[model samples]
Target: MIDRRRVLKALSKYPVYSPPFHNSEAVLSRSEIAANYNYFLEQKARRLEFLASYLRHFFVELSLSPEALPALDNWLLRYGGHLIPNGGEVLFAMNDYEPAWVGEYHGVNIIHDISIFAGDYIVMKNDKVRWSVNYGDGTKRDYEEIGFGQPCLVGLSHFAYTGNYSIFHGIYEFCYAGLRRLRNGGRGSKWERDIPGELVRRLNYLADPDPPPQIPVSQLTIDD
Candidate 1:
């Protein structure tokens, strides 16, 4: 369970800035902006640590391996195709692995932390766009949809047991909030609800137990 209080605290302190909302728009110096961006990233990194601790308890109870936790951390730091800065040294590569819109946009990058119920996977595309979801066969769904530059959070469940179950349950709530924020021109809309309900239904099928053997009705009639 994510600490509601902690998440609220982080959300309250999250930095705010106004920048032209286009990839080609010119802004301030890269050096100055980068400095502030690094500071913001540090705060996000700490918040991720908090989320990881919360997830650890769940993993232990389920007897699942915790190896995927580190990848989750890495995903957040580099999520949405932005690299973290440490004294001007790039900590990770944002090449084929980053979202497409990173270089296309000229402002502060957003961080989206995704936790799937099952499977261990990560993706990094250029800054233009990126998509990730669990398909229920140890394979993850990834793609770049049209209209990629918009700030959004998307979730998909092709298997009921995939991704964070709690998050899955709150999909509608998250989606409604995201849409509302987008309409109001909020800084960034939290995309918890962009997932399709149909997808969720299909995913439940993947998680279902094996079906029972079929019996011929004719055999029963003959016995009667």
Candidate 2:
């Protein structure tokens, strides 16, 4: 087992950024821009640490093995889901477009989910099971396989409804359950309000946490 505390501590060193470039013409120097970009990259690097720590906690809490956790991590990263790695195998699924999430453990790519929407979730298998419905006229859908360790990615649009509340709530619930299962063992309570502060803090960092890489503005020679 990896040392959770060390992992978190290392992750803390990773950088976090706000914004350095506000306007198009700021009259900034190359060194300054480079510095800012470096800061941004550092922040992203730090996020990787945060992700690793969260995964460790989630795994221990759920009594899952290290092997099982990586599969979940890959799913998060490949699909643009945020999480970081400690000193383990790391792998990434790549494309011209953003992945739904990505995961890495012991430097190996274990899970990947590629989706376009925010309210998307991946179904791993088709077990022919009857799934419960929360809204959308109380309709139920059956699948051949649903869970983890089977498919590289699954779409959740099939579960969407017509109403905004139903769509948002259902998608939120689906993501929360998927995340919880990936790290923690159980699902969170079904609340129609906002997520808790702790979760928010973690997620906020995950969203737009890193700065942009610096580029040499002087190298450009525009032809008029």
Evaluate model 2: give its lDDT.
0.28
TM-score of each: 0.23, 0.21
lDDT of 2 at 161: 21
Model 1 score (lDDT): 0.30
Error of 1 at 165 (Å): 26
lDDT of 1 by residue, 84-129 (tens): 2212211111111122223322111222223222211211211221
In model 1, the Cα lDDT at residue 4 comes to: 27
Model 2 per-residue lDDT tens digits across residues 1-224: 24334433433433332334321233334454354445434453344444445445434221123333334433332221123243222221111001212223211111111111111221112222212222122223311112111111222222222122222222233333444443543334454222333322322222222423334455554421
